[model samples]
Target: MWVFSWMSWRNSLKPPDSLVRKLNRLRRQERPPKREQGAKMGKRPRYHLQGTAFTGIWLLALGFLLFLSPPPDTGRCAPPPTPTAELVVRAKFPAGKPQPPPVTSTAAILVDAQSGDILFSHNATTRLPIASTTKIMTALVALEKLDLNKQVTVSARAVSTIGSKSGLEQGESLTVEQLLYALLVVSGNDAAIALAEAAAGSVEAFVAEMNKRAESLGLTDTHFANPSGVNNTKHFSSARDLAVLARTALQNPTFASIVSTRDFALPPLADGTKREFHNHNVLLGELAWVNGVKTGSTPYAKYCVVVSGSTEGVSLIAVVLGAAEDETRWKEARALLEYGLSLRPRTLLCDRGQLITQLDIGDPLGRQVNVVTDRALVARLSADQVATGTIFWEREARFPIRAGEVLGRLEFTCAGRSLGSARLLAAQSVETPNIDLLLEFWRRGWAPAFLTGRK
Candidate 1:
């Protein structure tokens, strides 16, 4: 059976007739002397025909196998991901209520700093990335828990942190106050890390404290996964929550001063080189009215800011998040601040002891007494409210007025609702004229006859 199989395989490799004839012709052309020498030496001569047949068979087999198989895939390269554009969220207003200025931000809010009243908002309670603005809470927590003058040594982990840095070198020593400036003014991620480790002995524990502080401040939509506000799924805050945080932070004098600083210089380092940091908040000097808070940005969070400003006794905190561009956040924040100011415009209606009007004590002689407000009256009214507002006088007592005596009240009312009021006081003493003479003069219903004739 083995011999039969070998014969069959040899038969399968047999060359065609044309190849066989070419081989025969080549053998005939070869010199007889070489064949005789090979025979005499008892050596087996090599045949070109056999080698060519074996190689051609192998090549044909390979070509057949290749033809039967599917082609290998050489995949095209995929394009890199483009950054996502900021979301467009519009605030909804009730019928007849004033709307905030149009802004392009994922979430935004405007609040009255003094009253904590939310003036305007858009998706204000949705949790989203906050970026370096997380330092606001960091500074606040540090101010409360860590001593400003305490010295802290920088760590390797802090020095290796990514994002905005304040030239912090590993093993460098710095005061808490200096790091606070670096954290807020320059949004230094390294400074944030160093402060976190110093405060809680670890980044994890410091983040826990941050969340705890957020919970205490009623920031339900806020969560802190890290001290530096690096891009993390668990690190996020809402516009409303951030505005609330900023308002709380501003209450701390140290925190308030740090965030408002435009430029700060740290003491010389070991190499005798001074490090200077410029605040990332553009609203500080460009808009003279803008006083505080923070600026933040990342690919995920886009650009965000918390802006505080006071104009005409109306203090407002405006937060804009997820703006498409860095400048967009500043522009949107400014618009929100200005719009909030316009919503609740404050006007000085009257100053203490300022004359409001003159009243006639006697009709015939018409002796005038200065009617003044006993206290300053400032009216805070919205656009619609101001449109429906009116001022009126109410008398509480009849005259024979004494200086500084409350004679009446000046009430400011809008839409039948009293906004504010001040007591009307007599600016000077005014004695009553004789009763009989006053009655006779009133009965005449005219100035004295001599004064009328002269006029």
Candidate 2:
């Protein structure tokens, strides 16, 4: 049986023809009956028990090994850690020495006209009766509103009014320009009325306009009830607001010239009389750079003066109200002017087209470009303070850029505090080679490419 089993296995292992022929012949020839005494024992399919057991044992050992090992680090389920805080502290100022007491006055202010810097003040914002100083603003408004050459007929009301006058006759006709000189230099109250009447048709209307102008100039602490600054409870202004008015008046070059004149001649009157007037402002003749401003005095409003001058390229305006005496006001103004001239002006750090920084471009030959300003940089500062600062380049850009394009910014700082910044512009334009052109130039010689260029 073992031999037969071996032969069957070998025959099955041969080819399909050998196994098929043997199976067909056995089916056709075999007819032996099973003996009842010896029941045929059915053949049991042989099983590879050892191999199955070996596979089961190996799988069990692998499962135990995997259970003892750490889990795979997937890294997907972890939460983020908290961030740490960074603390910063600022510098503290040291205690400074005590400054001397400011000069006493009923009203006073020391102002830098260009910067609108108020260096000192005492009762500067308090409203006080302003006498002929009102004429300053009145003259300024007239000059701004009326044509200098326009003719004005002196009316009975102008000539009949009862105050300081240029001896104007009712029948006389004069140009507005002549009247302005008389009004300013002589403090002619009649001229003020005539100017108001000519400019606004009436004193009341002109005073209303004056108040309107004061409001527009942010002079909240002032009010005007009359054109001549005649004594009235409503006609009042503070030293600070008057300083603002003075600055505004100086903005008009015509007004400045008019105010600065010590003496000026008026056009001939109808009777062939020429009016000569002297300025009440004493500083104009006494000080070298002092120009014409205005002065005022009344029982209610003591000696007052608005003095302005330029020295060493610096302009200053000093306002003194209610001085103890006429000459003291001038003296105080001179001191203030001298003090202002003594201060050292700040220096400008940059100028137009000045190079501020460099930018890198990807070009092989010219790898960087300069960034510059389109205009001059300037700042007003005291002489003692350091004006050092740094230029910061924009991080997102690379350059080879066109002129006038904004490239970066310059930040000005002092004592770790930012002052201001100016924009940086490209100094010039730049161009780059295209990829195809670069590749062609790399592949071929320069002479050949130049000689046979594409149209």
Highest lDDT, which number? 1
Candidate 2 on 1-455: residue-level lDDT in tens? 65565445334432236434744554444434465886876543223333344335434433443333222221121231232211122222235532323555588887878778887778899999888889878988798789999888888887777656777777667788888877877888888888999999998999988998899899988899888877899889999999999999889887887888788776666668877778888888889888767888887788888889865335788888888788788888888777665553434656778776566654433335677876655544454445554555554343225777776666665445454667878777754433333334433543223223533
> What is the Å distance of residue 274 in model 2 from its true position?
3.8
State how far residue 231 of model 2 sits from its true place (Å). 0.3
- Give per-model TM-scores: 0.60, 0.55
- State the lDDT of candidate 1 residue by residue for 1-455, as single tens digits: 65566445444544447546755665664333455544555433355444455446435543443333222221112231232221111222335645578988899999989779888889999999999889999988888889988999999999999998999989889999999998998888999999999999999999999999999999999999999889999899999999999999998988888878899998878889988878877879887767798998899999988889865446789999999988788888888887876666565655688776776553224556787877776655554444122224344333356888775666654445455667777788755433334434433663344322434
Determine which window of 10 residues in candidate 2 has minimal summed lDDT: 80-89
Instruction: Give lDDT per model, in order.
Output: 0.75, 0.69
State the number of backbone clashes in model 2.
2
Candidate 2 residue spans exceeding 4 A from truth: 1-102, 270-272, 345-381, 384-455
Model 1 TM-score? 0.60
Among all candidates shown, the one with the greatest TM-score: 1
In candidate 2, which residue pairs clash? Answer: 259-292, 260-292
